[model samples]
Target chain A: MSAFRSLSLAMLKGLLRDRTASFFTLVFPLMFLLLFGALFQNDSVSRSHVLQFGEVAVLDEMPADQRRDLSEALNVEQVRDRDEALARVSDGDADAVVWQDEDGRIELRYSAADATRAGTVQGLMQSLVQSANLAETGQPPAFELASDQVEDKSIKPIQYLAPGLLGWAIAMGASFMSAFTLVNWRKKRILRRLWLAPISPGTVIGARIGVSLGMAFLQTALFLGVATIPFYGLRLTGFWWLAIPLVACGTLAFMSVGLVIGAWAKTDEAANAALQLVIMPMAFLSGSFFPLDSSPDWVRAISNAMPLKHLNEAVQGVLTRGEGWGAALPAMGGLLLFAAVLTAVAARLFRWDDT
Target chain B: MGPLNVSNAAGRPEPGATRGPTEALDAARPAPPRGPAPPRFGHGYHRQVTKNIPAIAVEGLRKRYGEVRAVDGVTFEVAHGEFYGILGPNGAGKTTTLELVEGLREPDEGSARLLGQPSWPRDPGLLRRIGVQLQASAFFEKLTAREQIHTFAALYGVSSRRADEMLETVGLTEKAGTRDDKLSGGQAQRLSIACALVHDPELVFLDEPTTGLDPQARRNLWDLLREINAQGRTVVLTTHYLDEAEILCDRVAIMDAGRILRVGAPSELIAELGVGNLEDVFLQLTGREYRE
Candidate 1:
């Protein structure tokens, strides 16, 4: 126990003294969050719409009060003909086009270029026309159109991004830091010196794991704090404390991979190559930048197998999706299993001496 | 097992009688009289006859790398508290021999016993009783001299004060706060020595301890080594400089082709070879060929 503590303290001191490592571990993730937050500033749950009306006769028949409500709900524009309205929608100047045929049935047209946004606009228009028809006809309605959003309107995209960024922080902290430290130690023959000490390899590895997990927690806390405290002030809900265990599991899962690379690679260059090869693809496919919903089925399949994907889902679930611990169980379990299996492999491959 | 076996001389139990699970159970039995044994110390039985046991014993230790024999059938012993040196040219297996005895490498055949314990066992207790400084003593770059010593000391369950004392012993007190990477060659070497001796082990192994130091620094290190030897600790060192072996070692072994060519006191070996100095003796034994 004393050996473990002393080694861990030494490892922590080494990390603190390394300026480049400190930058990547603590500062890099925060910079990423700030950049993404700035880029996604206008991202919101409720989207604005520009609706072009192809026929003036339909609008003239509506009551003045209903017309005002429709105008307020959308940026209502009157086009001379259907061709002009279709051009506006196709050119991305308008979200949709609405026209009433001679039989009095409402027709809707919109581009499916951005399927999610288009779907939202279509639902809103459908509800609006249904209510308008009922009021104008003065008849008892067969059914009511009621709607509820899972996310609150005030929730910004940055709020959703904060959790994924937290996972990003863990991935960078654990994988990059562990890989570099291990490779550097091996290159310097520091591992050889430690091997001579009256401590087992297990103890040395355990100390490293402890230090990496500690740094992961610190990175997560600092990133979240900077994102929420002085900047976005995003509220984390639904068993937010579970983020602690989630970060731990994620750290273990990622550090195990780093350990394997460090143990297998003979040089620092090789280690860096391996780290980049794994981290870059995982970062993109794991929903760090955008949702994977519209991604190809195979891409989604690969993302599901990634530990980072599980981490992002669990963190976003708690911080943005208002999900409890039960909702995070599958991801947490996947991370734990990944950590266990990879750690076993790393242990088998770990070598104290360069030979 | 047999009624009072005759092999159990001096009223001591037979070696086999104390094997396996019965050893601990029988430890409390009154020890047989062995000619006024020394007072037993913590965790170690100090039998009077233990003084006869050499600090290190190697018998026919051999290691091979494919077709090459790194350490081929080497055999020697260092008396307790003696300064022993192994002198050889590059690639002559001096470091390999040292590493084998240090338990850092496994030998293909034969065995080594340090402090009466087999060196190849996975027992860390043996490591606690011995210290080693490899040829290139790499350390944590950001660790100060004091912290490095403290870290290694903690591994051996030594106190922080002892770590400080080791720094003082190696004349590194003033540079205790300097990061290891920032130190000069001599300072780093001294710090390495201090780390090795932090627990004050019974034996110490130094592989080319002064390989890259200036003359003055080398002389200073020699003085420190002499002091360590005076404190009744066994020291085994490997060096390319024959002068270092002559001036320091009580016994020197000259090796070539993965085997010992000669083993004796420096003066004795030189006199036997009809040479005036170790340089001549080494050249006469190793010949004009460049091993490296």
Candidate 2:
């Protein structure tokens, strides 16, 4: 027990004292969050801008109060030329172009560059055309479609970014930290020295896990803390504390990946190459930077295989979807299983010395 | 178990060289009389075993890496309180033999018993009594000399005070606060040795501890090693330097091609082969010019 404590304290001190490691493990991921935050800062559903090419009867026939609400949700600007309006849409000057033809057929053209905005515009235009058709038929509609968010309507895209970025931060930090530390230690012969000690390998690995988990907690706090400030506008809801265990499980899974890399690679450069090959693709496919809902089926299928995706699922569920602990169980289970299997592989590949 | 009266009595150091500050301490300590050896391992008596047996006994140990016989059919014994050296060239299997004996690597054939307990399968109970310093100096990353040794001492449940004293013993007290990576090669080597000896185990294995040091640093380390052996600890060192093996080792095993060509005191082996020095002795035995 004392051995574990001393080794744990020592390992923590070593990690803290290493400036490059500290920067990569703690500061780099926060940079990712801040960058994503800035990129999505001005994007909001209530602030979508739409260009109106011609007069639309659906808008004219709407009740004044409802029309006011519609105007408030979308900024509709009159445009003279169709070509210029298409150019404006292409340049991202407008979210979409909406017009009604002489035959009373409404058309909506939106750019796919921003998938979230495109989806929102498609949904709004579909509903508007449906109502227009219903009014034209002069028959009472038997069914109406009503949609609501699981979270507050005021929640921003950055709110979702917070949890996904948090998952990414812990995953990147834990895996890179564990992999680099192991490879560095092996290169320096520290592992061989540890092997010479009276302590068991379990004690050494336990100390490492303890340190990685502590770092994960700190990362969670930092990510959420910076995100919840008014500018970033991240709001945590139902069973948000469950993110703690979820992040812990994610860290374990990623650390096992690092262990495998560290065990298999004989050099620092080799480990780094392996990490880039593994981590970067996982981050992109797992939707750490963006939502995967609009992604193709095959891409999403690959994303489902990534442990980071499950982490994002559980974290975003609690933070953005107002999900409870029960909603997080499946993802947490998947993460734990990934950690176990990779850890077994790591154990099989592990060598005390590089030779 | 094969030969209790194996022939190496002539390899013992001279009476004058054996006398030191530890002589009185050694006299005051009770010596275990030779007796019928304890039953070989697996009886669950690990700690506080009688030291009547040899410090290290290995018979016909072998390890092969692919086609290369790294340690092929090696056999030797180290007596209690003896300063033993495995002398060889770069690829002469010195490190492999040490690793096999240290239980860091499993031998493909034969056995190694350290302090009367099997070294294979890595008996954790025997670890407390053995210390190992590898050929490469490996320290905790970015740690000061003091923190490094203190952590090593803590692993053995030793006090921090003893750890600090060990740092001073290696002449590293002045650099106690210096980070290990920032220290000079000699300083790093000394720190590595200090970490190994912080617990003061009965048997210490050092593999090329002074391999890359400057002349002054090497001489200083030689004095330190002599002092460690003088304190009545059984020391096993592997070195490629003939002069280092000559000056520090009470008995030397001249190794070549993954085998021991000769084993005896440097003076005895040189005299028996009618050679002027250990370098000539190696040349005479291996039929090649010694190059390290």
Candidate 3:
């Protein structure tokens, strides 16, 4: 039929026929979902049911005037002895001791023994005071008290990671592995013949880039599907479905970087070396495996610069936080810009017959 | 040995001197195009003078790879419907010059026009209309001959019927199911030609097309070339066999060290050395018997 049909058909067949590439492109994401999914499943997700804090007493030792004023916002209670309440918190008998000190200051003393309880206690205390303070001072807070972050819904690490890891898998397949395939075509003179054809060199490059991006997108979708449908019961609190296209675009942007590598490399070895150099750092620094939120500020800064980190933030924002399309648009725009620049460089510098 | 007598060309004639298979269509290619590319795979002044003018045109074409010149200072023309052969020993730069004219490589120094347009940065229509078979083709070895031809044919934006017809024309229709790795050398060679011509191109470039074939296989391919040329398509071929060149090509250009040492009709080039055979003429010019 037409060249377009033929080219598409050939591209599809080429991908299917190459088992290794196909594995990395299609199956690997699912594999990553399996490996990392199991590796980081949230013990808390299955246990999202309310947790028991054993027995503890609240210190209602605040004066009547202060207790009534702050108790509406904080979890402080009317108790007998304030010193005994402090003792409970230090002994881990209580999760946290909440009360108003003199001068109308809210105080919270909590155990950092259990990370889950510690984080929960810390957030509740801070939010309660912030809310109370906001109401008292009549000044807007730094953040909206009602963040669009899905409320009352808890997520496991897998719920958060499946999409982010899927993006990484697509990046690996589309960017690193694809370079080797192109290098093979170049070594065989197959690409040279294509270059000689009257079709716009743009078409040739475009087709290749298109095929790789398509594969990358597919990988992202497949992994998300596997993780959401089977393992985690597909629960996304934020607008995860809205984040799908953004993740796809972001993955493609990274994959195109691989196209640039493939075009510039003279041999398959050079392509491998170059591609791996790009892939490993992004994987580690993108916060794909662990939350870089707690990483050193410098390390977090480094991750923030990585496309994957932004992709994760962008993805987790949608999937975990149920972020809206409007809020996520800037991240998508950044990825699109990166893709355009890399694509231009790739087209201009690509060589067929390695000189 | 000008254009050979082809009055009795219908039957399969034995390989012999003083004969050509397409003498009947020699009158069709009347004249060559001019300037950039001579406008007429289907148009031109001597549309009827099919057997005249060069199939390719090159002027001061030069190419370099870093320090070495791969194709240097070359100019030549092939007549219409001519089985024009380029004969040179290995590393003699024959392929490089042919590639530049085919638009596979850009000439750093000069110009080449195919079918009357600047060949480099060629138009897709021009590329679709010209066939090229490199010395060695790298195919997806797992694909059958039919599948292989079908895949490349798509790149031309042409109908698959051309691939079917070419497979049949090359006598490989019976073996269309065979993978490239399974095909014998001669069969593989024919398949490459089928892939090249899948667009029904007007000009075919056969670079060392018969390099690895046995004698019988080579003879078979020669007849196929003759039939294709007889159909009024221009054939530009390069070969290591002087005898094959003498038998097949109406004219030949002897290249040495990135330049054309001489160019003329086989008879004229041979006659220039006062020799009666291609081998004698080759020895007279390069002072070497042969390589491979």
Candidate 4:
């Protein structure tokens, strides 16, 4: 046990001292979170949409009270002229433009660049105008539509992106870090020297995996605390703490992949090339950058086979979807199985010497 | 040529003698002794008092790589506290034989025992009692020499202070804080030796410990190794330098074509071959042609 601890401490110190590895393991994932968080800052349900109101000749004839109520209900911003409102709508500075035509009918002009936002603005305007018409006629409506959303709050893009990013951080940190460090040590015959010692091979491999798992947990906490907690207001639900084990299994799985590459590759360059080939596709196809719901069936099929996909799903299920341990079992099981099988293969093929 | 008895001429010091570092190093700087003597085993009446337990025993050990036989039917025994050297030209299976005895490689046939324990089965406890230094060692690039030795010492359940003592023994105390990558080749070689002996193993295997070192560094290492042997430890070394073997080894084995052509004290091997030195005997046994 003392030997294992010493080896683990030595490996951790070596990794920390390597500036390039520190950047990738500790700093790069945070950079991703900050970049993506800022990019999707406005993708929330509570964001206010701008409605530019243009000067209309017929507005003077309508009752002042009715016009005031309509304007307030629409959240309208008064513009000097139609031309200005049209320019604002075209530039996407406003969600839509509202004007009263000569015939006294309200008309709206909106950009189709973002169809969802355009439709939302149009629906809001229609409801406000209908209420105005009822008030003008001085009639009490027979039935009123009182609507409430079933979900507590709308799902934000960051909610989905945070878990995926966390998964990506773990995959990259474990796989690339393991592959590069292992191959470099093998090239230097450091592994050979360690093997010549009294320490068991299992202890050496355990120390490496333990370090990677430690990094994985650090990445999970960092991405969650720095990005998810502040920006997305992440709420942990039933069995939320299961994320810790999920991350461990996921990290071990990817680290085993790295071990296989490290054992098979003859040089550092080859290991790096193989790592990139594995990591890039896994990150993308696993929904690290975007949702895979709209992707083609074959892409989804490929994503289903990826360990990162399961990790992202399990994390997002508990964090964003508020699911329980039962919901994350499949992903957790998959990750554990992957870790076991790949670790076995890596152990079978592992060689202390370069030859 | 006539048989020569040069053991006394080598001027080996008695065990446990106190000497300054400089004086101890100077003791190994004598000129190579010449002349030949008949093969001798367990010389003089001392043979009767010394126990006969061999530190290392190998019988019909063999290892093959595809079509090449790296170690073919090799056999030898190293008695306790003997400074033994395996000398051969390039590709003479010297390293393969050492690794087989060190438990780093599995032989295709036959057996090897170290300190009465079989080399196969690879018992970690057995490895704890042995120390090995490969020809090309790789250490953590960022760890200081002291830290590297301390780390290995911890593996063997040895005290961390042993690292300091080992460094002092190898004459590397001044460079203890230098990282392995920054050390000169000779300094790194000394560091490797220090790490190998950090656990105070009963048996030590050094594969070409002085290969790339300058003359002074080589002599210094020879002194260190002799001191280690004097402390009642077995030393098994493989080297290409004939003079190094002739000076340091109590018994030298000249190997060629995966077999030992001769095994005896340096002067006795010279006498047996009717040659001027071990180098001439090696050339005569293995041929003058180059091997890649």
| Tens digit of per-residue lDDT, candidate 3, span A1-355 | 6555566556667668768767766776677678777765644421211112322222233335443443332343444666776677767666666655556665666666655555656665555455455555766443244221112323566766776676677678778645765676777677767766557766765666667667766766676677777565556665777666776677668767887998899887788788778887887789676556545779888887777777778777787666788657888888888888887998798776664
Instruction: For candidate 1, write residues A16-50 as lDDT tens digits.
Output: 89898788778887898888887766554335354
Residues A33-101, candidate 2, lDDT per residue (tens digit)? 998898878776545688888898776676665455565456678898988898888898899988888
| B1-292: candidate 1 lDDT, tens digit per residue | 1111222232433222423322321331232212222222211132222476778989999999899999999999887777789998888999889888888778999899998888886558888888888788678759999999988888888999999988887878888899988888888888899888988888999989998997657766776786777677888999988777766676688998899998876656666788766778899999988676
TM-score (all chains, Cα) for each model: 0.83, 0.85, 0.77, 0.81
TM-scores for chain A, candidates in order? 0.82, 0.86, 0.72, 0.73
Which whole-number lDDT from 0 to 100 does residue A138 have in model 1? 67
Q: Point to the candidate with the largest lDDT.
A: 2
Candidate 1 has which clashing residue pairs, if any? none
Pairs in clash, predicted candidate 4: B3-B36, B3-B37, B4-B36, B4-B37
Sort every candidate by DockQ, greatest first: 2, 4, 1, 3
Please give the lDDT score at residue B90 for candidate 3: 82
Clash pairs of candidate 2? none
lDDT string, candidate 4, A1-355, tens digits: 2788888887887888888878987898789888877787765432325554555433344456545543432345677777877887888877777787667788888898766566556665565566456556766451123111212223566777788888988998898878877788878867767767878888887888888888888888888787546655656666667788888888988888898898888897898889889998999999998777656899999999999999999988887677878767888888889988987888898777776
What is the C-alpha lDDT profile of model 4 across B123-210, one tens digit per residue? 8888888999988866775788888888888888888877788887776788888888888888898889888998899899999999
CA lDDT, every prediction?
0.76, 0.80, 0.69, 0.76
What is the fraction of true interface contacts found in candidate 4? 0.64
Runs with alpha carbons beyond 4 Å of true place in candidate 3: A45-55, A58-153, B1-48, B51-53, B65-67, B138-142, B178-184, B214-216, B274-277, B288-292
Candidate 3, residue A333: Cα displacement in angstroms equals: 1.8
Model 3, residue B211: distance off in Å is 3.0
Better model by lDDT: candidate 1 vs candidate 3 = 1
